[model samples]
Target: MARIRTIKPEYPVSEDLASVSLPAERTFVCLLTQADDEGRQRDNAAVLNGALWSLRPEHTALDTEDELRQLAETGLICRYTGCDGRQYLHVTKWHEHQKISHPTASRLPACPVHEPAGWCGKCKAKGKGCARPAPENFRSLPEALATPAEAISAQRPCTAATDLTPAVDVSAAEAAAPGKAAG
Candidate 1:
Protein backbone atom coordinates (compact mmCIF):
# COMPACT_ATOMS: atom_id res chain seq x y z
CA MET A 1 0.00 0.00 0.00
CA ALA A 2 3.00 2.27 -0.07
CA ARG A 3 3.15 4.83 -2.89
CA ILE A 4 4.00 8.44 -3.72
CA ARG A 5 2.04 11.68 -4.09
CA THR A 6 3.38 14.47 -6.24
CA ILE A 7 2.58 18.17 -5.83
CA LYS A 8 4.22 20.33 -8.42
CA PRO A 9 6.12 23.32 -7.06
CA GLU A 10 3.85 25.73 -8.92
CA TYR A 11 0.63 24.20 -7.62
CA PRO A 12 -0.17 26.87 -5.10
CA VAL A 13 0.16 29.69 -7.57
CA SER A 14 -1.26 27.76 -10.51
CA GLU A 15 -4.30 26.67 -8.51
CA ASP A 16 -4.89 30.10 -6.97
CA LEU A 17 -4.98 28.54 -3.52
CA ALA A 18 -3.49 31.54 -1.76
CA SER A 19 -6.73 33.50 -1.55
CA VAL A 20 -8.17 31.15 1.08
CA SER A 21 -7.47 31.45 4.77
CA LEU A 22 -4.29 29.83 6.01
CA PRO A 23 -6.11 27.04 7.83
CA ALA A 24 -8.26 26.20 4.84
CA GLU A 25 -5.22 26.20 2.58
CA ARG A 26 -3.41 23.88 4.93
CA THR A 27 -6.42 21.60 5.17
CA PHE A 28 -6.67 21.35 1.40
CA VAL A 29 -2.99 20.53 1.13
CA CYS A 30 -3.35 17.96 3.87
CA LEU A 31 -6.27 16.41 2.08
CA LEU A 32 -4.21 16.08 -1.09
CA THR A 33 -1.10 14.98 0.73
CA GLN A 34 -2.76 12.29 2.79
CA ALA A 35 -5.24 10.98 0.28
CA ASP A 36 -4.80 7.86 -1.85
CA ASP A 37 -3.79 8.22 -5.50
CA GLU A 38 -7.35 8.97 -6.57
CA GLY A 39 -7.50 11.68 -3.90
CA ARG A 40 -10.12 9.79 -1.91
CA GLN A 41 -10.09 9.16 1.83
CA ARG A 42 -12.41 8.52 4.76
CA ASP A 43 -14.33 11.72 5.35
CA ASN A 44 -13.79 11.67 9.07
CA ALA A 45 -13.12 15.03 10.64
CA ALA A 46 -11.53 13.56 13.75
CA VAL A 47 -9.06 11.57 11.69
CA LEU A 48 -8.23 14.59 9.58
CA ASN A 49 -7.91 16.73 12.69
CA GLY A 50 -5.45 14.25 14.12
CA ALA A 51 -3.40 14.36 10.94
CA LEU A 52 -3.33 18.15 10.84
CA TRP A 53 -2.68 18.69 14.55
CA SER A 54 1.08 18.52 14.21
CA LEU A 55 1.00 21.32 11.65
CA ARG A 56 -1.61 23.43 13.37
CA PRO A 57 -1.78 22.50 17.04
CA GLU A 58 -4.10 25.35 17.95
CA HIS A 59 -6.66 24.18 15.39
CA THR A 60 -9.62 22.05 16.49
CA ALA A 61 -11.80 19.37 14.95
CA LEU A 62 -14.45 21.95 14.22
CA ASP A 63 -11.92 24.14 12.44
CA THR A 64 -10.73 21.31 10.25
CA GLU A 65 -14.31 20.38 9.46
CA ASP A 66 -15.07 23.96 8.52
CA GLU A 67 -12.08 24.04 6.21
CA LEU A 68 -13.12 20.76 4.61
CA ARG A 69 -16.58 22.14 4.16
CA GLN A 70 -15.16 25.19 2.45
CA LEU A 71 -13.05 23.03 0.18
CA ALA A 72 -16.21 21.21 -0.90
CA GLU A 73 -18.08 24.44 -1.44
CA THR A 74 -15.22 25.77 -3.55
CA GLY A 75 -15.13 22.73 -5.83
CA LEU A 76 -11.73 21.67 -4.60
CA ILE A 77 -13.02 18.43 -3.13
CA CYS A 78 -16.24 16.46 -3.10
CA ARG A 79 -17.95 14.03 -0.75
CA TYR A 80 -19.75 10.90 -1.85
CA THR A 81 -21.19 7.78 -0.32
CA GLY A 82 -19.24 4.70 -1.24
CA CYS A 83 -21.00 1.42 -2.13
CA ASP A 84 -20.17 0.41 1.40
CA GLY A 85 -22.36 3.32 2.63
CA ARG A 86 -19.47 5.22 4.14
CA GLN A 87 -18.74 8.81 3.18
CA TYR A 88 -15.45 9.63 1.49
CA LEU A 89 -13.73 12.75 0.15
CA HIS A 90 -12.46 12.76 -3.41
CA VAL A 91 -10.41 15.59 -4.74
CA THR A 92 -12.09 16.92 -7.85
CA LYS A 93 -8.95 17.87 -9.71
CA TRP A 94 -6.84 14.85 -8.88
CA HIS A 95 -6.51 13.56 -12.41
CA GLU A 96 -5.94 17.04 -13.83
CA HIS A 97 -3.11 17.60 -11.42
CA GLN A 98 -1.46 14.21 -11.50
CA LYS A 99 0.18 12.32 -14.33
CA ILE A 100 -0.60 8.69 -13.69
CA SER A 101 0.85 6.40 -16.37
CA HIS A 102 -2.01 3.87 -16.35
CA PRO A 103 -4.21 4.24 -13.32
CA THR A 104 -6.07 1.45 -11.59
CA ALA A 105 -9.80 1.51 -10.93
CA SER A 106 -10.79 3.88 -8.14
CA ARG A 107 -12.87 2.96 -5.13
CA LEU A 108 -14.51 6.39 -5.17
CA PRO A 109 -17.60 7.44 -7.05
CA ALA A 110 -17.50 8.58 -10.66
CA CYS A 111 -15.88 11.92 -11.39
CA PRO A 112 -17.01 14.73 -13.69
CA VAL A 113 -14.39 13.59 -16.17
CA HIS A 114 -12.18 10.55 -16.59
CA GLU A 115 -10.09 9.33 -13.66
CA PRO A 116 -6.30 9.53 -13.44
CA ALA A 117 -3.99 7.54 -15.69
CA GLY A 118 -2.07 4.72 -14.01
CA TRP A 119 -0.91 1.19 -14.72
CA CYS A 120 0.70 -1.39 -12.54
CA GLY A 121 2.78 -3.58 -14.87
CA LYS A 122 2.29 -6.40 -12.43
CA CYS A 123 -1.48 -6.05 -11.92
CA LYS A 124 -2.93 -4.10 -14.88
CA ALA A 125 -4.28 -7.08 -16.82
CA LYS A 126 -6.78 -8.24 -14.22
CA GLY A 127 -7.51 -4.61 -13.26
CA LYS A 128 -5.93 -4.20 -9.82
CA GLY A 129 -3.87 -1.32 -11.25
CA CYS A 130 -4.90 1.80 -9.41
CA ALA A 131 -2.27 4.06 -7.88
CA ARG A 132 -1.67 3.37 -4.20
CA PRO A 133 -1.27 5.77 -1.30
CA ALA A 134 1.97 7.03 0.14
CA PRO A 135 3.21 5.96 3.54
CA GLU A 136 2.62 8.17 6.60
CA ASN A 137 6.32 8.96 6.97
CA PHE A 138 7.22 10.41 3.56
CA ARG A 139 5.82 13.48 1.79
CA SER A 140 5.01 11.35 -1.27
CA LEU A 141 5.60 8.17 -3.25
CA PRO A 142 9.21 8.14 -4.43
CA GLU A 143 10.81 9.13 -1.15
CA ALA A 144 9.17 6.20 0.58
CA LEU A 145 10.58 3.74 -1.94
CA ALA A 146 14.01 5.34 -2.08
CA THR A 147 14.49 5.73 1.67
CA PRO A 148 12.52 2.64 2.69
CA ALA A 149 10.12 2.18 5.62
CA GLU A 150 12.38 -0.10 7.67
CA ALA A 151 16.08 -0.44 8.46
CA ILE A 152 18.49 -0.27 5.53
CA SER A 153 19.94 -3.72 6.09
CA ALA A 154 16.44 -5.17 6.17
CA GLN A 155 15.81 -4.21 2.56
CA ARG A 156 16.71 -6.08 -0.61
CA PRO A 157 17.40 -4.64 -4.02
CA CYS A 158 14.94 -5.54 -6.77
CA THR A 159 17.13 -6.70 -9.67
CA ALA A 160 14.95 -9.38 -11.15
CA ALA A 161 14.90 -7.76 -14.61
CA THR A 162 18.58 -7.20 -15.12
CA ASP A 163 21.97 -8.77 -14.36
CA LEU A 164 24.84 -6.65 -13.02
CA THR A 165 27.48 -9.27 -12.18
CA PRO A 166 30.96 -8.87 -13.70
CA ALA A 167 31.69 -11.21 -16.61
CA VAL A 168 34.56 -13.69 -16.21
CA ASP A 169 37.34 -14.14 -18.81
CA VAL A 170 37.05 -17.46 -20.67
CA SER A 171 40.57 -17.26 -22.14
CA ALA A 172 42.16 -18.79 -18.99
CA ALA A 173 39.65 -21.64 -18.97
CA GLU A 174 40.30 -22.36 -22.69
CA ALA A 175 44.08 -22.33 -22.09
CA ALA A 176 43.68 -24.81 -19.20
CA ALA A 177 41.60 -27.25 -21.23
CA PRO A 178 43.11 -27.49 -24.78
CA GLY A 179 41.40 -30.68 -25.89
CA LYS A 180 37.99 -30.02 -24.26
CA ALA A 181 35.69 -28.17 -26.63
CA ALA A 182 34.47 -24.91 -25.15
CA GLY A 183 31.12 -26.11 -23.90
Candidate 2:
Protein backbone atom coordinates (compact mmCIF):
# COMPACT_ATOMS: atom_id res chain seq x y z
CA MET A 1 0.00 0.00 0.00
CA ALA A 2 1.10 3.58 -0.67
CA ARG A 3 2.04 5.50 2.45
CA ILE A 4 0.55 8.98 2.86
CA ARG A 5 2.73 11.99 2.10
CA THR A 6 2.71 15.74 2.67
CA ILE A 7 3.16 18.43 0.03
CA LYS A 8 3.69 22.03 1.10
CA PRO A 9 2.64 25.10 -0.90
CA GLU A 10 6.10 25.77 -2.30
CA TYR A 11 6.94 22.10 -2.61
CA PRO A 12 7.26 22.18 -6.39
CA VAL A 13 9.33 25.38 -6.63
CA SER A 14 11.30 27.52 -4.19
CA GLU A 15 14.60 29.42 -3.83
CA ASP A 16 16.63 26.28 -3.09
CA LEU A 17 14.57 24.30 -5.56
CA ALA A 18 14.67 26.57 -8.63
CA SER A 19 18.36 25.86 -9.23
CA VAL A 20 17.81 22.17 -9.92
CA SER A 21 16.41 20.98 -13.24
CA LEU A 22 13.29 18.88 -13.91
CA PRO A 23 15.11 15.55 -13.47
CA ALA A 24 16.13 16.38 -9.92
CA GLU A 25 12.62 17.60 -9.16
CA ARG A 26 11.03 14.36 -10.37
CA THR A 27 13.50 12.22 -8.43
CA PHE A 28 12.94 14.17 -5.22
CA VAL A 29 9.16 13.97 -5.60
CA CYS A 30 9.39 10.21 -6.23
CA LEU A 31 11.37 9.67 -3.04
CA LEU A 32 9.03 11.81 -1.01
CA THR A 33 5.95 10.05 -2.35
CA GLN A 34 7.42 6.58 -1.81
CA ALA A 35 8.90 7.26 1.62
CA ASP A 36 7.38 6.01 4.85
CA ASP A 37 4.70 8.08 6.53
CA GLU A 38 7.50 9.69 8.58
CA GLY A 39 9.27 10.91 5.44
CA ARG A 40 12.17 8.46 5.73
CA GLN A 41 13.73 6.13 3.17
CA ARG A 42 16.91 4.17 2.61
CA ASP A 43 19.62 6.53 1.40
CA ASN A 44 20.92 4.20 -1.26
CA ALA A 45 21.86 6.30 -4.30
CA ALA A 46 21.91 3.44 -6.75
CA VAL A 47 18.51 2.10 -5.80
CA LEU A 48 16.86 5.52 -5.77
CA ASN A 49 18.33 6.63 -9.09
CA GLY A 50 17.65 3.33 -10.76
CA ALA A 51 14.04 3.28 -9.62
CA LEU A 52 13.48 6.90 -10.62
CA TRP A 53 15.08 6.61 -14.05
CA SER A 54 13.43 3.31 -14.69
CA LEU A 55 10.05 4.78 -13.93
CA ARG A 56 10.64 7.86 -16.05
CA PRO A 57 13.21 7.08 -18.66
CA GLU A 58 12.78 10.48 -20.31
CA HIS A 59 13.99 12.31 -17.17
CA THR A 60 17.78 12.25 -17.57
CA ALA A 61 18.82 15.56 -16.04
CA LEU A 62 20.68 15.00 -12.76
CA ASP A 63 22.35 11.87 -11.38
CA THR A 64 21.28 10.44 -8.04
CA GLU A 65 24.17 11.93 -5.99
CA ASP A 66 23.72 15.35 -7.58
CA GLU A 67 19.99 15.23 -6.95
CA LEU A 68 20.50 14.14 -3.34
CA ARG A 69 23.01 16.93 -2.85
CA GLN A 70 20.55 19.44 -4.20
CA LEU A 71 17.84 18.19 -1.87
CA ALA A 72 20.24 18.35 1.15
CA GLU A 73 21.48 21.81 0.17
CA THR A 74 17.89 23.04 0.05
CA GLY A 75 17.20 21.85 3.63
CA LEU A 76 14.50 19.59 2.28
CA ILE A 77 16.30 16.25 3.00
CA CYS A 78 18.74 15.21 5.70
CA ARG A 79 20.96 12.19 4.98
CA TYR A 80 22.92 10.42 7.68
CA THR A 81 24.71 7.16 8.39
CA GLY A 82 22.74 4.91 10.67
CA CYS A 83 24.07 2.51 13.37
CA ASP A 84 23.70 -0.26 10.77
CA GLY A 85 26.42 1.44 8.76
CA ARG A 86 23.92 2.30 6.04
CA GLN A 87 22.71 5.75 5.01
CA TYR A 88 19.16 7.00 5.56
CA LEU A 89 17.24 10.16 4.65
CA HIS A 90 14.75 12.25 6.58
CA VAL A 91 12.77 15.12 5.18
CA THR A 92 13.22 18.13 7.48
CA LYS A 93 9.64 19.47 7.52
CA TRP A 94 7.82 16.16 7.76
CA HIS A 95 5.74 16.58 10.94
CA GLU A 96 4.93 20.19 10.09
CA HIS A 97 3.02 19.01 7.04
CA GLN A 98 2.07 15.34 7.55
CA LYS A 99 -0.14 14.02 10.34
CA ILE A 100 0.50 10.29 10.40
CA SER A 101 -2.15 8.37 12.32
CA HIS A 102 0.06 5.29 12.60
CA PRO A 103 3.76 6.06 12.64
CA THR A 104 6.15 3.17 12.35
CA ALA A 105 9.54 2.84 14.01
CA SER A 106 12.28 4.50 11.98
CA ARG A 107 15.05 2.03 11.30
CA LEU A 108 17.57 4.88 11.19
CA PRO A 109 19.10 6.48 14.29
CA ALA A 110 17.38 9.45 15.79
CA CYS A 111 18.12 12.94 14.46
CA PRO A 112 15.26 14.77 16.05
CA VAL A 113 15.23 18.57 16.06
CA HIS A 114 13.65 20.30 19.05
CA GLU A 115 10.57 22.26 18.09
CA PRO A 116 8.58 24.64 20.29
CA ALA A 117 5.25 23.33 21.55
CA GLY A 118 2.13 24.31 19.65
CA TRP A 119 -1.58 23.76 19.83
CA CYS A 120 -2.82 20.40 18.53
CA GLY A 121 -6.59 20.22 18.57
CA LYS A 122 -6.55 16.46 18.27
CA CYS A 123 -4.10 16.04 21.15
CA LYS A 124 -6.37 18.02 23.45
CA ALA A 125 -9.22 15.70 22.44
CA LYS A 126 -7.22 12.58 23.44
CA GLY A 127 -6.01 11.76 19.99
CA LYS A 128 -2.56 11.45 18.45
CA GLY A 129 -3.22 13.37 15.23
CA CYS A 130 -6.21 14.74 13.34
CA ALA A 131 -7.90 11.39 13.32
CA ARG A 132 -10.18 12.10 16.27
CA PRO A 133 -13.87 11.19 16.26
CA ALA A 134 -16.07 13.90 14.84
CA PRO A 135 -18.47 15.80 17.11
CA GLU A 136 -22.13 14.86 17.29
CA ASN A 137 -22.88 17.61 14.78
CA PHE A 138 -20.88 15.65 12.21
CA ARG A 139 -22.66 14.42 9.03
CA SER A 140 -24.62 17.69 9.12
CA LEU A 141 -22.36 19.18 6.51
CA PRO A 142 -24.15 20.12 3.27
CA GLU A 143 -24.21 17.45 0.57
CA ALA A 144 -21.65 19.26 -1.58
CA LEU A 145 -19.16 19.50 1.29
CA ALA A 146 -19.92 16.01 2.60
CA THR A 147 -19.24 14.48 -0.78
CA PRO A 148 -16.69 16.86 -2.20
CA ALA A 149 -15.29 14.35 -4.63
CA GLU A 150 -18.67 13.73 -6.28
CA ALA A 151 -19.46 17.45 -6.36
CA ILE A 152 -16.07 18.23 -7.89
CA SER A 153 -16.44 15.52 -10.47
CA ALA A 154 -19.92 16.73 -11.36
CA GLN A 155 -18.72 20.28 -11.99
CA ARG A 156 -18.01 21.43 -15.53
CA PRO A 157 -15.06 23.66 -16.29
CA CYS A 158 -16.17 27.29 -16.52
CA THR A 159 -14.09 29.27 -18.94
CA ALA A 160 -16.56 32.14 -19.17
CA ALA A 161 -16.72 35.47 -17.37
CA THR A 162 -15.00 35.75 -14.00
CA ASP A 163 -17.91 37.72 -12.43
CA LEU A 164 -20.40 34.88 -12.51
CA THR A 165 -23.43 35.14 -10.23
CA PRO A 166 -23.54 33.21 -6.96
CA ALA A 167 -24.93 29.67 -7.17
CA VAL A 168 -27.17 30.30 -4.16
CA ASP A 169 -30.16 32.40 -5.20
CA VAL A 170 -31.31 35.22 -2.87
CA SER A 171 -35.09 35.63 -2.49
CA ALA A 172 -36.58 38.98 -3.69
CA ALA A 173 -37.75 39.68 -0.12
CA GLU A 174 -34.27 39.18 1.32
CA ALA A 175 -32.59 41.15 -1.48
CA ALA A 176 -34.94 44.12 -0.81
CA ALA A 177 -34.27 44.09 2.96
CA PRO A 178 -32.41 47.10 4.44
CA GLY A 179 -28.65 46.98 3.87
CA LYS A 180 -28.84 43.45 2.51
CA ALA A 181 -27.74 44.24 -1.06
CA ALA A 182 -24.51 46.19 -1.37
CA GLY A 183 -24.19 49.31 -3.54
Candidate 3:
Protein backbone atom coordinates (compact mmCIF):
# COMPACT_ATOMS: atom_id res chain seq x y z
CA MET A 1 0.00 0.00 0.00
CA ALA A 2 1.15 3.51 -0.75
CA ARG A 3 1.56 5.91 2.17
CA ILE A 4 1.88 9.67 2.26
CA ARG A 5 5.48 10.86 2.32
CA THR A 6 7.13 14.16 3.04
CA ILE A 7 9.43 15.99 0.67
CA LYS A 8 11.74 18.31 2.53
CA PRO A 9 12.51 21.71 1.06
CA GLU A 10 16.14 20.66 0.80
CA TYR A 11 15.36 17.59 -1.29
CA PRO A 12 15.73 19.33 -4.66
CA VAL A 13 18.94 20.96 -3.47
CA SER A 14 20.45 17.74 -2.15
CA GLU A 15 23.80 16.88 -3.69
CA ASP A 16 22.83 13.22 -4.05
CA LEU A 17 19.70 14.07 -6.02
CA ALA A 18 21.66 16.49 -8.16
CA SER A 19 24.19 13.80 -9.02
CA VAL A 20 21.56 11.48 -10.50
CA SER A 21 19.48 11.91 -13.68
CA LEU A 22 16.00 13.47 -13.56
CA PRO A 23 14.31 10.08 -13.90
CA ALA A 24 16.42 8.68 -11.07
CA GLU A 25 15.49 11.64 -8.86
CA ARG A 26 11.80 11.08 -9.56
CA THR A 27 12.19 7.38 -8.83
CA PHE A 28 13.79 8.14 -5.48
CA VAL A 29 10.85 10.33 -4.47
CA CYS A 30 8.29 7.86 -5.80
CA LEU A 31 9.91 5.09 -3.78
CA LEU A 32 9.32 7.14 -0.63
CA THR A 33 5.53 6.72 -0.96
CA GLN A 34 5.80 3.03 -1.89
CA ALA A 35 7.98 2.12 1.10
CA ASP A 36 6.52 0.68 4.28
CA ASP A 37 6.61 2.40 7.67
CA GLU A 38 10.15 1.14 8.22
CA GLY A 39 11.14 2.46 4.76
CA ARG A 40 11.69 -1.02 3.35
CA GLN A 41 10.38 -2.03 -0.08
CA ARG A 42 10.87 -4.67 -2.74
CA ASP A 43 13.80 -3.85 -4.97
CA ASN A 44 12.49 -5.54 -8.12
CA ALA A 45 12.74 -3.21 -11.11
CA ALA A 46 9.65 -4.68 -12.82
CA VAL A 47 7.45 -4.13 -9.76
CA LEU A 48 8.79 -0.64 -9.19
CA ASN A 49 8.25 0.30 -12.81
CA GLY A 50 4.73 -1.08 -12.75
CA ALA A 51 3.79 0.70 -9.54
CA LEU A 52 5.61 4.01 -10.01
CA TRP A 53 5.84 4.58 -13.74
CA SER A 54 2.85 2.77 -15.19
CA LEU A 55 1.42 5.95 -16.69
CA ARG A 56 4.64 6.62 -18.57
CA PRO A 57 5.06 3.52 -20.73
CA GLU A 58 8.33 4.94 -22.02
CA HIS A 59 9.93 4.34 -18.62
CA THR A 60 10.86 0.67 -18.73
CA ALA A 61 11.99 -1.74 -16.03
CA LEU A 62 15.53 -1.33 -17.29
CA ASP A 63 15.26 2.41 -16.65
CA THR A 64 13.89 1.76 -13.19
CA GLU A 65 16.78 -0.59 -12.43
CA ASP A 66 19.26 2.02 -13.56
CA GLU A 67 17.56 4.62 -11.35
CA LEU A 68 17.64 2.26 -8.40
CA ARG A 69 21.33 1.67 -8.94
CA GLN A 70 21.95 5.40 -8.98
CA LEU A 71 20.00 5.87 -5.78
CA ALA A 72 21.95 3.08 -4.04
CA GLU A 73 25.28 4.41 -5.25
CA THR A 74 24.44 7.93 -4.01
CA GLY A 75 23.71 6.62 -0.48
CA LEU A 76 20.09 7.81 -0.81
CA ILE A 77 18.99 4.19 -0.35
CA CYS A 78 20.45 0.85 0.70
CA ARG A 79 19.79 -2.30 -1.31
CA TYR A 80 20.27 -5.74 0.23
CA THR A 81 19.09 -9.30 -0.05
CA GLY A 82 16.76 -10.36 2.75
CA CYS A 83 17.01 -13.69 4.57
CA ASP A 84 14.10 -14.74 2.38
CA GLY A 85 16.49 -14.44 -0.60
CA ARG A 86 14.62 -11.46 -2.04
CA GLN A 87 15.98 -8.07 -3.08
CA TYR A 88 14.94 -5.20 -0.80
CA LEU A 89 15.78 -1.53 -0.39
CA HIS A 90 15.56 0.86 2.54
CA VAL A 91 15.48 4.64 2.44
CA THR A 92 18.49 5.87 4.36
CA LYS A 93 16.78 8.96 5.85
CA TRP A 94 13.23 7.68 6.25
CA HIS A 95 13.15 8.07 10.03
CA GLU A 96 14.69 11.52 9.86
CA HIS A 97 12.35 12.77 7.11
CA GLN A 98 9.00 11.02 7.67
CA LYS A 99 7.17 11.75 10.94
CA ILE A 100 4.48 9.09 10.98
CA SER A 101 2.02 9.75 13.79
CA HIS A 102 1.08 6.08 14.28
CA PRO A 103 3.32 3.98 12.13
CA THR A 104 2.00 0.69 10.79
CA ALA A 105 4.18 -2.35 11.32
CA SER A 106 6.38 -3.06 8.31
CA ARG A 107 5.78 -6.28 6.36
CA LEU A 108 9.19 -6.10 4.66
CA PRO A 109 12.53 -7.24 6.01
CA ALA A 110 15.07 -4.74 7.22
CA CYS A 111 18.36 -4.21 5.41
CA PRO A 112 20.98 -6.57 6.82
CA VAL A 113 23.87 -4.30 5.94
CA HIS A 114 22.55 -1.00 7.37
CA GLU A 115 20.31 -2.46 10.08
CA PRO A 116 21.09 -5.24 12.51
CA ALA A 117 18.94 -8.35 12.73
CA GLY A 118 15.70 -7.65 14.60
CA TRP A 119 16.53 -3.96 14.71
CA CYS A 120 13.79 -1.96 16.47
CA GLY A 121 14.76 1.64 15.66
CA LYS A 122 17.58 1.71 18.21
CA CYS A 123 21.16 0.62 17.74
CA LYS A 124 23.01 -1.49 20.32
CA ALA A 125 26.42 -0.30 19.17
CA LYS A 126 27.17 2.88 21.14
CA GLY A 127 29.89 4.44 18.98
CA LYS A 128 28.52 3.43 15.55
CA GLY A 129 26.16 5.78 13.75
CA CYS A 130 22.46 5.03 13.25
CA ALA A 131 20.90 3.69 10.04
CA ARG A 132 18.89 6.90 9.60
CA PRO A 133 21.03 10.00 9.24
CA ALA A 134 20.03 13.52 8.18
CA PRO A 135 20.22 14.16 4.45
CA GLU A 136 23.44 15.55 3.05
CA ASN A 137 22.06 19.08 2.59
CA PHE A 138 20.02 19.08 5.77
CA ARG A 139 21.43 20.33 9.08
CA SER A 140 20.34 18.87 12.40
CA LEU A 141 19.03 20.92 15.28
CA PRO A 142 21.62 22.98 17.12
CA GLU A 143 23.04 22.10 20.56
CA ALA A 144 20.49 24.42 22.23
CA LEU A 145 17.60 22.29 20.96
CA ALA A 146 19.20 18.97 21.95
CA THR A 147 16.74 18.62 24.83
CA PRO A 148 13.46 16.79 24.25
CA ALA A 149 11.25 19.61 25.55
CA GLU A 150 12.98 22.19 23.38
CA ALA A 151 12.96 19.91 20.36
CA ILE A 152 9.22 19.21 20.70
CA SER A 153 8.38 22.87 21.18
CA ALA A 154 10.50 23.81 18.19
CA GLN A 155 8.15 21.89 15.92
CA ARG A 156 4.80 23.30 17.08
CA PRO A 157 3.37 26.69 17.89
CA CYS A 158 4.85 28.13 21.11
CA THR A 159 2.72 29.92 23.66
CA ALA A 160 3.41 31.42 27.08
CA ALA A 161 2.13 28.28 28.78
CA THR A 162 4.00 25.83 26.59
CA ASP A 163 7.07 27.94 25.89
CA LEU A 164 10.35 26.99 27.54
CA THR A 165 11.29 30.58 28.36
CA PRO A 166 9.92 32.47 31.36
CA ALA A 167 6.28 33.55 31.20
CA VAL A 168 5.31 37.15 30.47
CA ASP A 169 5.10 39.62 33.37
CA VAL A 170 1.42 40.72 33.30
CA SER A 171 1.41 42.32 36.72
CA ALA A 172 2.80 45.61 35.35
CA ALA A 173 -0.05 45.92 32.82
CA GLU A 174 -2.65 44.99 35.43
CA ALA A 175 -1.39 47.63 37.87
CA ALA A 176 -1.23 50.31 35.14
CA ALA A 177 -4.97 50.11 34.37
CA PRO A 178 -6.88 53.43 34.04
CA GLY A 179 -8.69 53.02 37.41
CA LYS A 180 -5.53 52.04 39.27
CA ALA A 181 -2.88 54.57 40.32
CA ALA A 182 0.86 53.91 39.92
CA GLY A 183 2.65 53.42 43.21
Best by TM-score: 3
Give the CA lDDT, 0 to 100, for residue 106 in model 1: 53
Which clashing pairs does model 1 show? Answer: 3-141, 4-141, 5-141, 100-117, 102-118, 102-119, 103-117, 103-118, 104-129, 104-130
Q: All models: lDDT?
A: 0.62, 0.59, 0.76
Model 3 Cα RMSD, Å?
A: 19.4
What ranking of all candidate models by TM-score puts the best one first?
3, 1, 2
Evaluate residue 174 in candidate 3 and report its C-alpha lDDT on the 0 to 100 scale.
95
RMSD of each: 15.6, 18.6, 19.4
Q: After superposition, how far is residue 96 of candidate 3 from its true place, in Å?
A: 0.9
- In model 1, what is the error at residue 67, expressed in angstroms? 0.3
Model 1: lDDT of residue 132: 38
Per-residue CA lDDT of candidate 1, range 6-124, in tens? 78788768454665677888788767767776666777787888986656678888788778776776778776543344556778878778776766665454322233343332234
2 or 3, greater by TM-score: 3
**Segments in model 3 whose C-alpha atoms lie over 4 Å from true places:** 117-183
Model 2: runs farther than 4 Å from truth? 57-62, 112-183
How well is each residue in 33-130 modelled by candidate 3, as lDDT tens digits?
Answer: 99988898877889999999999999999899888878887999987655455667899888999999998866566565666644433333332323
Which of the predicted structures, 1 or 2, would earn the higher lDDT when compared with the native? 1
**Candidate 2 at 79: error in angstroms?**
1.3
Worst 10 residues of 2 by lDDT: 114-123
